[model samples]
Structure formats: structure tokens, C-alpha cells
Target chain A: MTTTLTASKEQSCQTLLASGHTACTGCGEALAAKLVLGAAGSNVIVTDATGCLEVFTTRFPQSSWEVPFIHSLFENSAAVASGIEAALKSLGRQNEAKVIAQGGDGGTADIGLQALSGMLERGHDILYVCYDNEAYMNTGVQRSGLTPFDCMTTTSPYGEFSWGNKHNKKDMPGIAAAHNIPYVATASVSFPKDIENKVKKALSITGPKYLQIHSPCPLGWRSNPQLTITVARLAVQTGLYPIFEMENGKITKVRKVSTPKTPVEEYLKIQGRFAHLFKSPDGNEEIRKIQEIADRNIEKYGLA
Target chain B: MRLDLGAIAKAGTSKANQTCGWRNFKPIFHQEKCVGCGLCKIYCPEGCVTMVEKKKYTVDYTYCKGCGICAEECSSSDIEMVVEEK
Candidate 1:
């Protein structure tokens, strides 16, 4: 079943994401970035960290970016963005241009954390978007800080005694807000309008803004690629990815789940990473732990 | 003894471009019945809220942006949004 999403009220999704990229079928990361760029429009400079989104979208000699895009090291997208913004400011062209930093889970949550923190602390006039697919998909799906506990990755494979990742995903949004930036938000590909609206708002705002976007990776997660958007939608439904925004280091708004929150199992069962959580006797205990984490998140976010 | 006030003087809104309508005020607290779970403190995005005492908390209004999270997450209906000032 193909979903015909209505064009965003502010921008069109069609040409922004465009067609003929190298992304695997149903890549949520690509969709998320595409919609964001579409909303951002032209006159924007994007700095991308090396990851699935970067490798898949841009091939040497062939490019898919409709706007000015720069490819940077695995952990320097934020710093690169800082430079871009500085150049724009130095030339007194700040008002005419906008800056964005893009990366995956590893680039944003792990390897790139330092640069990301520096960029935020310095309060550069740029927007940083982390397309979180949980693992470092570009690097063969290894576990990353954003990887949820008990989820299986290439590095954290499930076994008779092992339950895969042991730690919960790091709270990057909180870390970003710690820098005292102007705006920060958590969004999902499921909510295009919200993400688009946030991007538009961030474009206008000075200072730094961080957006953690929940994208779904099918190849890495052992799920159907077509379910990319659906998986992201369920993530919010399950209360795993709460849609909220923080301003000046305080929670300003949070979007509530529709009710009768989707069971954690419903989300886990769809992805191969969590398949072991239910199938094995030892996995059940880990599953319980994972469920508790989700419950805690629901309570913490008031998503009931 | 020379004090370079340049850093402080140049640190108004110019170093950082202040955005408009970027923040919304949402007061979140269980005013009377708060158990002071402090869960909000743990999950607060900015970590700006602090516990005044037992079962009591105060938001550093100077930094609070009114996310309404304390009210939403508080099991008790004690946390609520009150628009006082920016």
C-alpha cells in the first residue's frame, strides 16, 4: 500500500526529496532529510556527516542535492556547519542564507558528540538534525549510543546468553539543550508537518537548534523497506519517540500519543533487531526490561 | 589591572541571533498535590527545574520556556502552566 502524503502546507515534498537516489527501498532517513530540505527550500547550506544518508544520497561524480551540500568527516558535520555559518556572517550574508548539519546515530550520538556539543555551546547560527535509525547503518549496522538496549546490531548480535545492546539510547536532545541553545525538538518522519514547521521556525531563529528525527532503517533492522514511515509512526504510537520541543532549556510543548498506546511488542516484533527479545526464554526478561524503559518514557513524557 | 569587558560587552544578541516566537511558556507543576517525583527533573530537556525542598520544586523562570512537560508527566495534577512572564 502506497501512501500519498499531502504536500506540506508550506512546501512540496515531491522535488525536494526528488527521485533516483541510491537509498535502499523505504529509507526513512532519506525521507526525513528530504522533507526537511523541502521545507527549508533553497538558500540553505547543508553539511552532512559520513553515514548511510550521505553515502546513499551522494555518489562520487553523481549528486542528488538540489541545494548546496557539503560532505564532511564522520564527526565534523557540526563544526563544518559552524564554519559555513561563520563565513555567511563574516560576509554579512547571514540573513540571506541558512545552515544545517545532518548526521546519523553514530555521527550525532557517538563519534560526533564532541563537535556537536562544541557547535551548540558556541551557539552557532545553524540547525543540526540527527536522523536516528538507532545504529550506525553506514558502518554495517554497528551499535551506537542511540541504539536502544536489547536491540540487535551487527556488533550486538543476539545469542543464547546475550541479549544484544545493554544500554538505552543516549539522550542527545537533553545534551543539546544543556548547551543553552535557543531551540531543540524531537520529531519523527511520521509527523512531516511538525518536522517541517520546526525546520521553518529554526531557519528564522538565530543561535543553534537541534532536532532529533526518528527515521527507520529497514536493511539494518531486518524489516521491509516500505514500512519506513510506518515504523516511525509506530515509534511515536508506542511512546518511544515523543514529539516535543524545548526552548531556552525548558520543555515548551509535547504531543500526546493518540491513546491506548501501542504495545512495545508491536513495535519490536516488526523489526528483526528485537525479534530475539520475545523468542528466547532469556529474551523475555530483556524484553520486560525494554518494556519498562518504554513505560518509563511514557510516564516521563506524559504520553498516556 | 585591565579588565577586558569586550567579551561581556559583545555578548548580547549579536554573538547569537535571538529568534522570535521560538519559545512557548508552559508551566508544569503539581502545585498543591505534588509528590515531587523529580521524574521531570530527570527527563527535563534543559535541566532548568530544581527541587526547592521535599515535594516542592521551583522553575528558574529566567530560563524556563514553558514546555508543559512537568504537568503532563506528573502523576498528580499539581504541575500546571502559569504564564507569568518571559
Candidate 2:
């Protein structure tokens, strides 16, 4: 049962997502897209939102996708995917290809929320993936609904009067699971195998599924491009980004953090977005606040 | 009567657009020192790293953005990022 995605080192492998796109150097979204598509295999249809993922992959007469990919507006990819799924069902060929709708955090947790919720509520046989890099990376770094609390961005810049965003990060996976869908999972780019496994598991189950990947953005996050994997790994180790799977409105699995849990500073120090927290007089207080969030996650998921 | 959608592109035509010009650094694969971990193949955002054989890997420069991820993540440090001299 060796596919091109899971092909071992000795086997010849064919990636469904081709190379030579215009994504920023070491873009985590692009890497996650490749990993997801590879896991989905060639028999899948992808509908993309107008974000970095779509903008970079499809440029006029060039497309990095080897399989069928459709793009329209930023807020309607999930709707479009629903229509595609219905079309496949109407034609009695639903098994021919798996349907995937993808978007950035801005497109998913903000603008496209309505369509996504509709798709999930309607129980459409599709997989919706949100490549959450925290901010709107493509159209300059702006604060998004999924952006973490006290994170610096263009719209939520830290200043003498402000401490980054005033809102806490939206629990997207929890919202998706609240719909009582068949599956909802969170993964990070650090663990490519986790992503591959979750994608396969979500696709294997029927009905609507949602997968949110914590893809690290080097440019937007102001982190080192070469340390994209390192940043993603540290995020999970710090308990800032909990990896887990939910089935039938219940958490079925969780990736536990090893003993001597990594503090939030180790995760925050790598990204320039959190740099203001260390230099400002109110920085330590905010850092403590962030550590509380991680602590809550560790307690909630038993990731100690 | 007739539907007029926008222009259509062929599948995987992005391969035709060589991205090697974007690279300031080139990742040189030292096959002799390779440990066959396949970490480079998994981490490359460009998907340019390919496993040539067990304990061997090759990167396609034509599409390599030279982000240095492969070199930075190589298990055996078999992949080195060198300044691409014109």
C-alpha cells in the first residue's frame, strides 16, 4: 500500500504538487500544501481561496497543482467545494475523487466562516483545511481572527498604548468539532507524518472534516527561513500549539509534550513578532499571560 | 447560451518556470556523507529534493528556491548551502 506520498526512500516517488511556484522562500504554507496534496494522492479536487496558497501556486498560465484545482473568491472556496461534491454525487461518481477546500486563517476563521459552517452543517462530503499562519501573510501581515493574543501585526502592532492583539486566538478546531462532524484535527508542519496521517484519516471518514495546520511563516512571523521546521516543532513542544484529533465530538488522541515542558519563551524568542514582549517594560507580564495559555493547553490536553 | 470562463492553464506547467534565479545560495548534496534519513526530502518547501537511492538524495536546482531548509535540516549535514557564484 505504498503511494507516492508514503513512498519510502528506496521507492520512486511522484509529488502531486509540482515545484517552482512563487511562494516566499521557505514558506510553510507551501510546504504544508505539498504534504497534504501528497497525502491526498492524485485523485482529488482542490478549491483554493485567494490567499498566499492560491496566489503563489497559480499564477496566470502556470499552476503548481497536478490534480484538478479551482479558485474563485477568498470567501467561497468551501461553498465551491460543496458544489463540486454535490456534482460528483449527482453524477454517481462521488468516489472518483476526494474534494478538498483550503484557505488561509483570514479566509477560514474570518471571511469564509459562514460558508465553512454551512458546508459543515450541511454534512457535505468534503475536507476543509485551514493553513493558519496567524496573520494575513499575503496581503501584508495583518491581524486575523485566528491570530494569538498579544501578537504583533500590522493591524495589531504593539506600542506605548497597546500590547499587540487584545483578543484571544479563536478555537477553530473546537468550533469545527462543535458542529459534531465526523472528524476534526489539528496538526503542525514540524510533524509531517502527523499531517499525512491526519489528512488520510480525515479523508477516510465520511461527511465534512476540518484540519487546521499550524504552518510557520518565516517572513510574516519574522523567523529564520531555515528554521521553519524548528519553529514549528518548538511551538508544539512549548504547548502553544497542541496537536490532537477529535472524532464524533470527542478528543480521541493528543500529542503529549515531553517532560521538562518547554516554556513559551523558547517558542516566542524565535519569532520577531513576539520580540517586543521581551524588550518592553510590560513584556514579562505579557509573557506570563502567554505562559498561562500554554499551561491551560497542557492541562486541557494532558500534554505534560 | 454559452459559458465564457477565464483562461485555463495546463496541469503542472509551473515546472516550465525555472526558479533557480531566485537562489542566492545553492544547496550542494554531498552524497558520500549522506545518512539516508530523507529529512531533506521531507523539509524542502519547493519539493525539489528527491531520494535518488537509499542513503542518497538529489535536489533539482531548476526549481530549488535555495531556502536552505534542506541544508539546515540535513541529519548528517550532507547537504551544504553555498553562495551561488555567478
Candidate 3:
């Protein structure tokens, strides 16, 4: 499909997710979407759930998707993808196009979990990717099941009445692995190459595969737009977000923290959502608890 | 009203939307300081940066939202973010 080269970086673009989306400046999910589809190539059908990615990219007529993409609802992307897979197999054209079902944290961890479970149980040949930006970002920053402990959201606003989202982030990778899927992986948007490689790896495997990608939200997370990659990198280095792969319920590989394990404060201080945790003695205790969570993750994942 | 088509948008591309007006600061690429590492192209969220010639890169201002990620992630600090003028 190479034509006269365009000056707008459109022809040189190696991705199926096109540019000029309405995603906030320095949107990590948009970047990750490009990386994922770039690796998966054009011969694929994508079923997306309602989220920032779907909303911004497919704004009806002014679309950014260069491939066949569908957004049925907020909680049925997996079911829709399963139908697509079955349809392809029935038509004897399963080999031609790969099916990808994707959603945000709310759709994946909370709203769409049942459909996802059914898709996994049925063993559909589709990749289910969760872009966990830690909240219901598209519909205003509300706390989702995957929202980290003490992270501020509209529903879990920090105050005397509450410490933002008292519940810890749900173990979605573990849940996906429990389904005995062929492959499950956790990725961050900072590591674009790793994400692309993991998308390729998941597509190569048969049976249901799960990829939970942690992308940053500049507006929701109250972080600087320019520091999107930096914030994601710090999340990994702090051991708060573990990057790993699971094969049939077994942890195969993990991204280890470097020599100087980055302090959690380096990550916390950059985002305004976590700014409340630095205010008082009570906040220090909360900060310590958050650090303990990071420490535990580092030890649990053998990141050191 | 009853219709045969099941709600589908006409064929379109987001390229129709010129997001350049959203820019608060624009990145000015300095060719002399560039080391040709291509990190800017890799990290640009909008996918607006491209290599016009070997080791020389240019950004598509038509679609660039001016997030300054290219400038921030630049290895040699070749891309500098300056306040957008009008």
C-alpha cells in the first residue's frame, strides 16, 4: 500500500492505528495502541470496548483506525471478538485475520470480567488486551477495581472521609493466568518495544491469550503531559508495576529493577493525584503504606 | 425511522482533524544537535515525526498536538520546546 510518501508521517507509519486522535497530549494508551497494532500488522480485526482509546480514535467519521475495528459496548468486546473468531473458523478463513479484543481497566477488571471469563473458558483464538490506566478515565476519573490503593479519583476523592481508593489494585494477570490460558503478560507503555514484542508473541500463540498493559493518563493521573514516558518508566523502576510474562499459570520472565531501586516517592511526587499523600503525618503513614506495597511487589516478583 | 443500515459512520480519517491548534508549546528540531538515535520518533505519542532523510527527522505540524515528548525524550536534546507564537 506504499504510495507517494506523505510529509505528515502517514506513509512512513508502520501502524494500523492512525494518528490525529483526540487522546490527551502525551497519551500513553494511544502510543501503546499504535505499538500493539503496528506489531500485529494490518491483517487483523480489532474489537474495542468503550474507553479513551475507542472514544478518541473512533469519533465517527473522523477515525484513526486503518484496520477493521468494532466497538460494540463497554462490556462485550471479548464476546464480540469470540463471535468474530467463531465466524472466521466457520468460513474457513481463520488463518487470514487475527482477532483482538481490548478495553480499559473498568471494562476489563470490573464491568467486562464475566464476558472475558467466558471467552477464556471457551478458549477462543483471540488476544484480550486490557489497557489499565487505573480508572474509568473516559467517563471522568472514577475508581475502578484496578485503581491502586490511595490513588485519587472522582469517586474516591482524598479527604477526611476517605483515603483515595482504599482497595488495592486487582490481580488481573493472576486471574487471567488462572484460566490456564496459553499466555498472559503484563506490560507498560514506557517499554514500547517490549509491548510490540509481547503483542507479537501473544498473537503467535494459539488459544486465549491475555495482555494487561499499564498506560498512563495525563489528565486523570494529574501528571505532566510531557512526562508520560518518564512516569511509566518510574512505575516499573519503583516496582509498583511488575512487567512479566506467564505461561500456563507459571511466571516465565520478569523485568528486574536496576541497581538503585527507585524510591516510590520519585513516582508519587510527579503526579498531583498522589500529592495529598505528602501533606501531613497521616499522609506520611499513607506514603509508608504505599512504599510497603511497592517493597512487597519488588520482593514478590523478585525484581531486585 | 426504519433503516437497512445498522448505524455506521461514513469512511473517514482523523487526519481531517488538524490538532495543531491544540499546541501550547511547539518543538523546534535542531539538526546540528541531533544524533540520529530516532528515540524522538519512537516516543512521539502522535506519530507525527518522520525521517525525511537519513539521520534527519521532521515533524508534521498539521497533526502534532505539541506534547513535547520528542523534546523530553530526545537523547541529544536536539528538540527544544518553545512557547507557541500565535
Candidate 4:
């Protein structure tokens, strides 16, 4: 596959998310943000929350944001973005800039959910993207609400009697769709062109839009940095993560997986959080459950 | 198909508040020449690891914390560490 990042993307992509901003090598969140911003172009104002992406991309007096970006509080990015969009519209400057709110899973699925909900409900001609690494990675890998069941986190240690996490990931796209936004989609960093195209499509539309992008974390997920895109591809192939688009509160299309259902094990067996599954049979049931979830998702979204 | 301006107009009135977070860990296991002996279990801190009825084991990351202890105690070079994709 030829990634061949565009010159516009390469030139504008942050070589420095900040001079000394700290991010683990192969941080998917950072890459996803850079790509999305590059696609959105400089004619946009971004409201960001305090999360792994924000903390590592912008520090005092140093920032990789070549566009107009603001670091709002953790739970208020959507509200801030809404205000920015409103102000731009009222001032007849809407054409001067587009509005975007960004955050990681913690900020998007848990802490900032209310503000995000409000922003979507109000239909403020803005685009909100969630770069989901699936944990409170910035805060020492604590388990967040979006964490999958039995996945290990700092808070959820794999023990004899207890699994790491205990709940399914929240259906964020479903929630967004309920708002009846004109456009809602799921994307991943591995497919930059798809994400860029979706962003362009959203920009052309005249109402609120939502994009949930999968970003594979290296340190938190315990994988090789170079394999970020590979893991992303595996996720899509395994049906563990489905890429699709929803318009006007309905599913319109889904990205097809190139191969027959890849084993969830192929994807799971490569990560440290699931090492226990190889240790004993007890983990098999959970694996089956996860596979079932993915299979159901594939069936629902027609990813097969 | 014509773009639905009514849907666009309705999106403005629905009023949604929002926030987001992430919590997922990827697990890695090395399967080399070895007996299917499950010692990683007695040591797992999160109880996320377990064996299948007739096959290999599985990791329940909903509970696994990505600690390296299991890899550390592997009698065989059967389990390695892998980072989870976001």
C-alpha cells in the first residue's frame, strides 16, 4: 500500500506536536489529529480538551497547531467549539473558519459527554472527532468508561477472580446518530484518504457532523510503534472495528473488510493486555464474547 | 438524491451535549513449543487470562491491566508484550 502522505499533509504535519510535548512513540491519537487537521486545513478553529492528544500536542509557548486551536478544559471542548461556531456565524465570519472539537476517549465518552451531546443536539455546523485510544492514557492508563470489558488498565488489574474492565464500550456513534446529525462516520488513522474524504464531505455539508476515529496507542496498548497502521488494519479485518457512515440518522454505507473474518485472536494475541488469554482457558469465554460482539457488528453494518 | 435540508435544520434544534474518553489495552502472547500449562493464571493480577475447553487461552482485557508479570514468568518463550492499537 502506498501511504504517500500528500505534500500538504507532510509539510503541515507537526514534526513537533510541541518542542518537548510528551507522547509515546507511535501514538495513534497524535497521528490521527495531525492527519485530520491537515485535511481540515488551516481555515479552521479547533477546540481541544485536556487529554493525551491535547497534552502532547500543545504546551505553553509551543504548539504544533498550524491552525487556530484552543485548549479548553477537559469536558468543555464541545461547548467551547459550539460557542466558537456561533460567534463565527453571528459575526458573518462563518466562511472564514470551520469549527472542530477534538478529544480522546476519556474526554469524549465520559467527562465531556454532556457538552458533546449538547453540541450535536444543537446542530452547530461543526465537526467533532474522537480519536479513541480506548483508555485514560494521559493519566497513567486508568480505565475509562469506553474501555472494553476485561481489558487491563492501571485501575483494572488482571487478577485470579477479577478481569481488568467489566463493561462494553459505549456506542458513541449510535448516540451521535440519535442526534440526527447530517453526517456521522467511523474512521481510522490507517486509511488517511478515507478520513480526509469524509472530512471534506462533512465540510461541504451545512450541519453538525461526528467522526469517531480509531487511534492505536503504542505505549498504552503495548505494541510496536511502526505497526500502528497494521494493527488498525487488523482491527477492521477482524470486524472488531467497523468503518461506516451514517447520514440523517441512518446507516448509509460501510467499508468492506478485504478478507474473511480475521480471527479476533490474531489481533488480540499481539497485545499485552490480552496475554492472559494465552495462559488459561478461562479467557476463552471472554474471547468468544468479544468475537460475538464483532461478528454482530459486522452483521449490523454489513462489513462482511 | 436531494440533500435533506429539513434534516439539517432539525439537527440545529436537537441540541446535543458531548465529551469523550478512551480505555482499551491490547494483549500479546507468544505461542512456541510448550505444553499448554497455564501458570500465568496463578500470577495474573487482573484474572484476564484463561484457557479454552479444547484449545488455547484467551485474555479478558476488560480486566487485564497490561502488566508484564505474565510475560516475566513464562516458563517457555510463549508470551511476549504487545501494545494495543487505539
Candidate 5:
């Protein structure tokens, strides 16, 4: 069946998330948004939380969204999306459009977690996408629940007394899976096709779905903007971020690391956020710990 | 460019805002080397890269911020990032 649902290359260029927004050059979140929206197609309503995507895409006089879009409080996008879905069902238009709730890591893993959990438990037909850049980038780079250990943020500055964020990144996808959502997946901006396919698959399911996308932030991570895709690719290649899909609380697919696996240092050294980790002996020890984290993920997920 | 206070602007009106001035490097596409893989178009953050007949690609510089993502992501090295002439 030739459903125009699949995102062809030409169709992807004219997606619901149009070009010419004020997102920073080479913004991974912007790219991920485009890919996700393109895959979801025009027949969708989007609910955006207060974050970089919302701020840059909907700047008063200009909007990048072409579909029905709504902005809610940072902590209420999932709730807002549930209401939209319920209204669609009430109007007997439940099949007319899909509802998508999107936000950054801060909104999804921290501020909005309660609302998201409520929506999932209620079994709403909504898709919640968390663009995890690992920090609260729009609010001037604050440390977030999803922030990786030893990563520097404005709030987790590296200095004599501290070593960046002292906590491990929150396992958001695991949390979502534990809720027994119909579908849950982890993706990266580096793999556009993978991201698109995952979104399409999530939308095909009938109940609550969650997608956590690893979107790189050049400004917050202090990496060159041109290397956005490269950075995202290295993240998965290094095993720091495993790309996988779960269905009915079971692992269904895994993107394995090919031979000659990339080392964690290769991924960490590119971004200035981890630059301090390469400077001192203590920093080297931290790098070792970070590698151990990646090694554990590799072993657990069988990524190799 | 007059926008009423607290009103959401029309979709895609940012096209009126010229961002080419922000570019320090411009991506030049070589049609001969392009294999029509469309990876450049896929990875372009601005979504300004247009595919001609599914084979040739052209980038709209009007809004291209010279991020060089297309050039960096082009698998065949068909797209070159050149310093913009001031």
C-alpha cells in the first residue's frame, strides 16, 4: 500500500516544521523536530512545552510549524495533549489527526515527568517526544535530570570544588517502558531515517507512546555546530547512547555497534562540556568512569 | 514585518528574514559528484536544500546559515563548504 505516510526525500524538505526559524545554526533539536514532524505528516496536532524548540520555533511573529500547534506550560504538555486527544475522540475525529507532545530533557525528565506519567497511565493516544540534549539549554544551560555525569553546565560548572554534574543521566526510556506504554524507543538525530521510522511506528500504535531522541546542542555542549550530526553519531557509536526499541515492555530491536567500536573519549573530547575531563589526572579517572558506564550499556544491550 | 503584539505569526514567515548574512561559509554543490543519495538534504537543519528531479540538489541560500551540515554530511563529498566572499 502506497501510503504517502513514509517520508520521501522530496516530501521531507517541505515538512510541517518548515525552514527559516530562529533555531541556532546546525541545531540538532531543530533537525530532529523536522524529521519527527515530517514522519508524523501534516495530519497531526503538536503540543510544545516551554524549551528551546518552543522558544525558537514560535517567536511571536514567526512560527516554523505548519500544523495545528499549541504551546502549554513547561510541565503540562502531556496533559494538554491528552485533552486534545480526548476532544478529538469526543468530536468523533480521533482518527483525523495524531497528537504529539514534545519538549526538551528538562521538560520531559524533570518538570513534566508527573504529567507524562499520568497521561501514560490514563492510556491516551498521544506520542511524547523528548529531545534530550542533556541539559536545560534554553534556560542558559542548567543541569537537568538527564544531564550525564561530569558534564559541565552553567549550573554544573567545573572547578576546584566540583566536577560538573555529579549525577548519571536519568533513564527516561526505561521509566517510560516500565509504565508499559504500547511503544517506546530511543533515537538520535544522526540517524534521520531511524528517527523517522521510529516516530511512524510509534504513531501507528493505539495508545501512549514515548520517544527519547538524543539531540546535540552546539552552544550548550561547546561543540562546533557543523559537527552536530557527527556528534550524535559518535554518541551512539561510542555506546554511551544505545539505540533500541521496546514493545509492550519488551526489547524488540537493537542497533548494534559495528566492528571497531568508537571509544568514549572520542565522543567526549569533541564537546567542550567534557573538555575539563581530559585536563587532569582526576579528570582522566572520571573519563574511566564514563567509559565504564558505556561499557555497562554495551554489555546490557548487547550493542556490540 | 509588522507583527501584532502576542500574536502567533503566520507559518514560515521567517522566510522574510534574511539569514544569509549570518553565514561565514557557503555550501557549493557539485552535480557531477552527487550520487543523488539525498543525505545532504536530509541532514540540513535549515531544510533549504531542494532536490531537483530526485537526482540533482540545489540549496536555497536565502535562509542558509552556512552551518556546513550538508557539506559535512554529504557522503560522496559532492558538497563543498567554501568561505563566503565578503
Candidate 6:
């Protein structure tokens, strides 16, 4: 964490993701993108998938990115990044520059999963960052593969007949690690240092790397814009979102929860998307189920 | 505020677009308790908080969306969210 302080100090003077784009007031993806680009620095080339980040940051005539960036459709950021990496290698500039492929959860876990898997299997020198806000936020909040169970969205609406999204979030980090890449980690925007350190570490490695960042969406989550970081922190503390690193398909580091760990309710109550889970008997049952999911993650990942 | 049609837009054009009017609460930095750790500056989504002196910092209200991250992440609890008047 001390290193994070130094990184922040260094980043403050030379920000790569300049603000002023049209992201929401407390957009988690925007914050995560800033931290990612800041950590990646100016020497890297960025390949973005068509998602909220691409839509908001590069709005036609105006662009927020200061580095060489390419917006390659909705599902080819990883492939595009691989191509860039190959090009850089052929040009004898691979060591001097890094390649980063970025996308939202929908782009990463759903549409772009094939390209991402191909890139990982190929062992390309690229860092694939998935800013997971849980759903297809840019396409008016449709439920994506990464959308958590019992969470509400436009497509996965909670009503008399339904309980929001039916399926659990896809284990993207596990999928990435299955490729046996050098680095794979889950981070939250609430913990900037962890994200920075992971990005730095991933870049230091040669082969494909995956970093899925748990970024909350205030608009989609129906949470107060000001409480973005609070909600993100609660997600990590509650064991719902485990922040850990894997090397060669083995767990190398885990960010343990603080003493007297926060409960899942603390994380769920803040978002309107999870409001239905706190309403009635069935809702309470759903909450219990969600809590069980958290408990299972804690047990599985040894988050305690 | 003028747009240059041919030239690429400035990296931080949001600075010229005042967003404080949309905020219901604003963060006030109390200088006495400040520790100049720059955590607020780093976590600020708008990048509105700027270091004035070594130990002093100020928020540029024009672009700040008043997300309160600065207040929340402030190590010394120096930044407080005050209700903004209409």
C-alpha cells in the first residue's frame, strides 16, 4: 500500500487518462480506466472493445486518451492487441512499449470471450483488463454473462415471475488462469494501489495476463453517486468479490478481509439493483442465498 | 470553451464544462487537518482536487461532480461534504 502512495503521487503530475469525458458523475469504470492507464503509463498502446469505456471516452471528434489507442469493434480488443504486440515486436519496439486490451464485462465475458481466449491461448504479450460493472451498461443495462444472480437489470428485471438474473457471474479470472498465463488477478477501483501494482506486475510479464476489476456502476446499480467507492470497498470486504493474484494457475497472494468482516447486506443494501432482495419473504430468501454465495467464496478463496 | 474543429480536443475538456451546478453536495477541505498525502487527488474521478502547496490542496469546483470520494479517502478526515445551496 505504501507503494500505492508513491504511485499516486507520481501519477498525479502526469495523468494519462485526462478527465472531461461524458462518463457519469461517479462512474466506476471511468475511475478504473484512469487508474489503469495511469499505471500503464504513456509508453503503452491501448486496444479498446466497444463498450461504455469506448463510447464515453472516445466520442467521435473528442478523445480522452493521451496514448496510441484503437477501438476494435465489440469483441476483438484482445485480438487487436495481439496484432499490435506482434507489430511492435516486428518493429523491434516490443520491449519499449506495452499492449493493453480493455473492455467492459459484457465485452470481456460475453461477446469478447472468444477473442480473449484465443489471445490467452496464443500467449501473446498483452494485458487484458476487464472492467466488470456486472452488465451491459452501455447498451441500456442488459444482463451479461458476468451479471450476478438475483441482481436486477433492464433485461433481468425482478418481478412476480422472476428474480433478476438467474445465473451466477462467470468465473472470468478462473477462465483466464486456465490458460496458464503468468498473472491473473481480481481488483476493485476502491483499492487503487492493488490495481496499479497488478497492472505493473502484469506488464512486467511477457505472456497474456488477465485483470478483472470489480467496478460498480452507479447508474446501473441505482446507488448514490457519492457512495461508489464505499460500495466497491464493501464488495471486497464482504467477500463477495475476492481480490487475489494467481501465478501459473496457483494462488500467490490474497488480500485478506479486515477483522470483524463486513456482511453481504452492507454491500447489497446500497444498490437499488439489489433492492428487491430486501423487500419480502422471497426477497429475504434470495438475500440468504446471496449471502451463502459470499460465504462460499470466502471458504473457497480463503478470503479470511 | 471554443471547439477547434480540426485540432484534436484537449485531453481535459471537462474542465471548461462546469459540472458543479449538478452537485447537491460539495467537498470542503479543512487545511488544519490536511496531511498532503494526495490520496484524494488520486481517487478523485474528475481529477478536480489539485495540490496547491506541499501540504495544501484545493478542489476545482467547476469540474468536480461532488462524488465525495475526496472526503471518503482523505487520510486525515480533512475533506468534508457540505450541502450546496440552490
Question: TM-score (chain A) of candidate 6?
Answer: 0.96
How does residue A172 of candidate 6 score in lDDT?
Answer: 92
Tens digits of per-residue lDDT for model 5 on A275-295?
999888888889989999998
DockQ of 1: 0.01
lDDT of 4 by residue, A1-304 (tens): 2233332333233221222224454566766776676568767888888898776655443455556677759999999999999999999999998898998889999999999999998989999999899899988888887777678888888888777788888899898888888999999876766777888888889888999999888677877664666677788888888999999988888887656568899888877876777678888998998899888888889987
lDDT of 1: 0.73
Better of 5 and 6 by TM-score: 5
Candidate 5, residue A301: how far the Cα is off, in Å: 1.7
Candidate closer to the true structure by lDDT (higher is better), 1 or 3 = 3
Q: Would you list the rank order by lDDT, best first? A: 2, 5, 3, 6, 1, 4
- Candidate 3 TM-score, true structure as reference: 0.95
As for DockQ, the candidate ahead, 1 or 4, is 4
Ignoring the other chain, what TM-score does chain B have in each prediction?
Answer: 0.61, 0.91, 0.86, 0.58, 0.87, 0.82
Poorest stretch of ten by lDDT in candidate 2 chain A: A1-10
lDDT of 4 by residue, B1-86 (tens): 88653111111111111100122334466455435555343233233356653225556554354544456545565777665665
Query: In model 5, how large is the Cα lDDT of residue A107?
Result: 96
Q: Candidate 5 versus the native: TM-score?
A: 0.95
After superposition, the stretches of candidate 3 with alpha carbons farther than 4 Å from their true spots are A1-13, B1-4, B10-12
**Which 10 consecutive positions of candidate 1 chain A have the poorest summed lDDT?**
A1-10
lDDT of each model, Cα atoms only? 0.73, 0.89, 0.87, 0.71, 0.88, 0.85
TM-score of each: 0.75, 0.96, 0.95, 0.74, 0.95, 0.92
* Candidate 1 residue lDDT tens string, A57-152: 565544567677888699999999999999989999989888999999899999999999999988899999999999988778999999988889
Best by TM-score: 2
Q: What lDDT tens digits, residue by residue, belong to model 1 across residues B1-86? A: 99653211111111122111223545656458876555444323223456777777766554343445445445566777665444
lDDT of 6: 0.85
- Estimate, for each residue in A242-303, the C-alpha lDDT of model 3 and write its tens digit: 99998888889998875677888999999988999988778888888988999999898888
